[model samples]
Target: MAMFSTGGFAQHGKSKKVKNAPVFSQVVYQGDDKVYNEHPLKAGEFYNPILQGCYPDPAITRKGDDYFLVCSSFAMFPGVPIFHSKDLVNWTQIGHVLDRTSQLKVHDTGISAGVYAPAIKYNPNNDTFYMITTQFAGDFGNIIVKTKDPFKGWSDPVKLNFEGIDPSIFFDDDGKAYVVHNDAPNRGEALYEGHRVIKIWEYDVENDQVIAGTDRIIVNGGVDLAKKPIWIEAPHLYKKDGRYYLMCAEGGTGGWHSEVIFVSDTPKGPYKPAPSNPILSQRYLNPDRANKVDWAGHADLVETPDGKYYGVFLAIRPNEKGRVNMGRETFILPVDWSGEFPVFENGLIPMEPKLNMPEGVENKTGKEGYFPNGNFTFTENFTSPQLDYRWIGLRGPREEFASVLKEGGLQITPFPVTIKEVKPTSTLFHRQQHNNFSFTTTLKYVPKSEKDLAGITCAQSERFNYVFGVTKKDKDFYLVLERTERGTSRVLASTKVELKEPIRLQVKGIGDDYEFSYSTGGDRFVRLGGIVSGDILSTNVAGGFTGCLLGLYATSANDILVE
Candidate 1:
């Protein structure tokens, strides 16, 4: 993570505006094992972990009957995922910010460095909602964009002259606006890669600049009570009952460490820790008898029309030994203000799909989209924009790398010809199904050569992937599954392919690894690979800042791999 060094951050230029604003989408999941995260969702209770997956450092804003939210996308394209909710309880994803490569310099970014915590604030004076995200780990500082409709048109990122991580926006009751960013630039040179201590600086919205008010380091190093290392970032502020609070996430982002809260007051001095400072840690949840787990934390707080407060945070989920492909998903927790300080209660508000009358949204589950007869399609180039909020990449989504129909059906091209390139180019994936589910899809391929290939993968990591594809050999093709676990394909089976047919693949995720079955007839599938990507590969075990990603992939030849 690059820290803010000298004075002015980011190269300044005329801020252009992006046209289409992102949308809100709903994700519906089905299968058996009806235990909302091994537990049930009870209302009016502080539901812990409102979301379960990779939705980190949530910064949200409410407008009328609609609610808008954004999350940190480390390396995924379309950097920030924008979501909308009518009643806060139910959310739908509409679209993503930075719909192109020009919005980012992804190659320069590494794990967890693309987009950080964003502050979403609607400026009345400007009559626009500004979304500020930290790119390049605050080296180039923040990217500020604005819109009249959250679903479209944000002014191109106006590279504000400031550097810091975890930027936030605040609209004072007196109408004075300010931007609070995280970084202690004045505290000396790059120590511990500038992640040592983070502070906040106020910015002037009118001039599209940083104003000189108080850029103080309010909260010092966070609660390091987890017997492990700790750091603080993602700062959000709101004034209530004549008191100011700077709410933030503490501890590291994984394991039993992640949690959210604030220094009970101030722009400067005497800020006390929330009574429930580490209120909602999955580590604090009833530990498993086996005693093994990890949870992520980064959150945003919102208040409903009736004045009820809810916190949107992150947590991980398990499907037997296998974990979710989409890690750090957003979960809803209520602010337990019953005590002197605010705390997030426990619960996993099931992410609903559009096809199922919005389960949990309509308060009904066991019916539509849950039955085997129910229809669910992932046909090549299939899309449902209104239902994509459920889809999340483990890290940052740079540029406009993906789309549902946003680019016309999950348009995936090549970044590199092979995984060996480091940036596996043509990959557009969705979260692995969480329950006892089955996955099937038909793919049409045009592999120019054995080097140019496309395949169906149940991938946990580069080392652990079950690839079923048609590799061209002279003028013919073969059905293959390569398990590159031991530095090469340990399981390599290539069958002759009928040139005129499409490959139909089916994956049954039963106990442990998904069973891969293939067919040329498109009627019945024959087992091709067994138990590919065995388990979730162990947390932090895989390099990328994500869980296993399951979907389609393609690669060009090495010569075309680099552009």
Candidate 2:
């Protein structure tokens, strides 16, 4: 298997000045299988984020007792990660929808410029799962794929001629299927910056083609003509109590983000806005200084077996500077439907981390809780035949450059793609799930040239990153600490070291700061430099839709694809 890079970075013109922030780290999964807050498990109680770390735009569907869900992967190669849940609380990753390169084509994508929002739905009639998503700014526009067994593999993509982002498929009760998406306007000119319309098209799922003449606008701009919200996206269609409900995210995806509902008598007709418009939003709520789960919207609903309704939506946890480095994570909350429409809460949704699980659902997974119990540990021994499922690549697959050593450890071949470019960078990374954690890795190879380097990195994107690399200059070895804030990169510290011995690199994350250190042979690591502010790598600072990635990488400026 080859190595790959993951996560987005701060880009030009979109970069925000880094702010001085305090240290804060939320305890997620420890090393052991137990939640950090070890409250006794009950029948109707669980934590939020069934899936964690840059897992956004959650689309969940249930088949009998088994629940299957998926999330958007952006530029990551294995796009759309799918998970299985016996009860919505405990979820295990089954596989990826676009696991093979043939199913997905990604190359030289900018930060958050690949696959946008993915809608995964199961068709009971054919017993197959269909996943439709948009390849934003990619070679293909909208694409679809399916699989009988989600764990094994999915078929190649069926490219759709839809010109929009966040495409979703809705299979009506009458067996007719339709796709609702944020349709682009005509080519000439626009009155506003983000003026886009929502449209629905008659789709032929069996033949994997859309009917030509059946396209029509369902929503002109967005609800509340007075406010005139722009960027009406993340559209999902549903039927509730004989009324067709069309839910979409409006007012862009930042602070003003919100979920609005539209109801219509017919599947495709004049739709009216619900009285309780902007049903779920944190814009009015006080800034959550504690968890920072603000910017709540872009949701998908799923009804449980016991007739309980729950909505999985996207939310962010920002740092002290209001800069979100964790990206948009998936959050689940129960929907109370006692009134005319389904309500997530009485008013705007609250940051309810501890929620009551769906009724009649017991913990059948036999696990203690959703997260592990230790302080936060990810030690890849490199003993497995395949790389860990959590490991991700930049724009390509693991077969591109990195491989696991037979005896132990990992061997990352130096690729010609420099860390400066977003495309073709050779790196293998996992989500920096915890706010505070320590990452340590031992390097077995020595750099032969100034351009050839290998070590660990905490990256917001290819253009914005913090790298702790091993390098050589003038036949002397050195440990280097480099920081790439937006488009600017510079070395913070470097020291000469003996090249005969293996090197150990360490990066300790404390809230919005990262401390880098390294050792020559033993565990006697020395600090490389002062604490590096992490806000430079935040989505707010970096201006991307992804969180930070903690992983290993190797760079060869010569474009060589080998060691």
Candidate 3:
């Protein structure tokens, strides 16, 4: 983990002007949510969202006493974040399944168009683990990766011949395998706007490909097509008591989202919709309920070693303005499978923030090596050579533009690309995990021109974001704030600054309101834009599948116009 800083800053002939790279000494993020403060966690109680902040479309699999879970990572480099846990409550991120650039080829794609709904399953037949997913970019649709050991690494992706999304692999008891995915109805036979079908194919596990001419339609148009369910996707297959079961997400991934189930006698057949469809949902609950959790669907079920069942699904917690800024997160609920169909216990009702811990399982979250859940504070001083897994780059590898300096700091070589472009920029990003939080960073940078800017950016996508940085205006230096919404850009505030030493920048989110401030060699921070609406950074307004990203941005092509 040696630093990558060697060449000095000098102008190359006919190339873009190179300025002194920005050095970020430290970054601090503190989460202080009121919901957690009011309804504090009691003994033997844990939070509903096991993993927060844009970790959606959860799929879990159990191998022996170890459980492995994965989630969708759209356009983020090192796609398909994989986590491991011994007890279902305590989890730790091992590493990404697609860490190499050869496996993740989303460098030219949009922020929301890469990996989607990754399914990780362990095949006891061969003592191997397979991760199947859809890459919306690079024309690499429906691919699978495998590894004998998930703790070490995974193999490069082998593209599967498929024309659909949300592909999952199921291993049968008879040493056979099948792939289930969501696709369009038969050619020209689509009846409604959201009409979709679930198709299954016999998979050749040895060769890692689907057998030709073996595809069959399993569930058409979701449960009860007469009612017209929209977006019947994220299908998973399981076998219990010698019966094959198919489960899917219906009614899109919004407020009407839900999980439905169907049963069949064989691997592929005329599957019968469960009489108790929508085994899990929160759509019918009161929207104004305190600490509300909505859009609960896209679930995958796993059995505990002690014969208990639990489901991992995606849900959201909107701010007071009814806007989704944190994006969809992962939540777990006990499943009651004593009946004909498994149902999420108390999932149909308004969800509570706390859940009773399993018998003899201590809540080790945020401690030892387990991933944190509740309120916490994280600080990074860039002293270590190895970057934490929490820091990620969009559409490209972080090592390409970022390097740890020998003098103990992070040096970001300014990329010619701006944040508004679909191309990968020199910005290190961390997901905005809480609605009420504060993020601050210490920066040592001085802009050479208006085209040179370095500071922080809160981005939802290429079209919607806020740029707050230090730039030179004529002969004077200034701190500027710019907001971009729906591809349009406007400056919110700008102030003159006398930069004699390293400055500090901070952004605080109070419910739906966000404040941007700066400090110059002092403890007092001056608010720049007063209190501005965080609507532009929300998925409701941004219209993407990602949460807000707090980015350490630097660009030689800075375009925030200042008057």
Best by lDDT: 3
- What's each prediction's TM-score? 0.76, 0.89, 0.96
Q: Worst ten-residue run, lDDT, model 3?
A: 5-14
Clashes of 1: 54
Candidate 3 residues 293-358, lDDT tens each? 999999999989888899999999999989999999999999999987899999899999899999
- Root-mean-square deviation (CA) per prediction: 8.9, 7.8, 3.9
For residue 529, give model 2's deviation from the true position in Å.
1.7
lDDT of candidate 1 over 402-441, digit per residue (tens): 3343333333344444543335245555555343556566
On a 0 to 100 scale, what is the lDDT of residue 280 in model 1? 64
Alpha carbon lDDT at 57, candidate 1: 65
After the best TM-score superposition of candidate 2, give how far the Cα of residue 1 lies from its true spot, in angstroms. Answer: 20
Rank list by lDDT: 3, 2, 1
Rank ordering of all candidates by TM-score, starting from the highest:
3, 2, 1
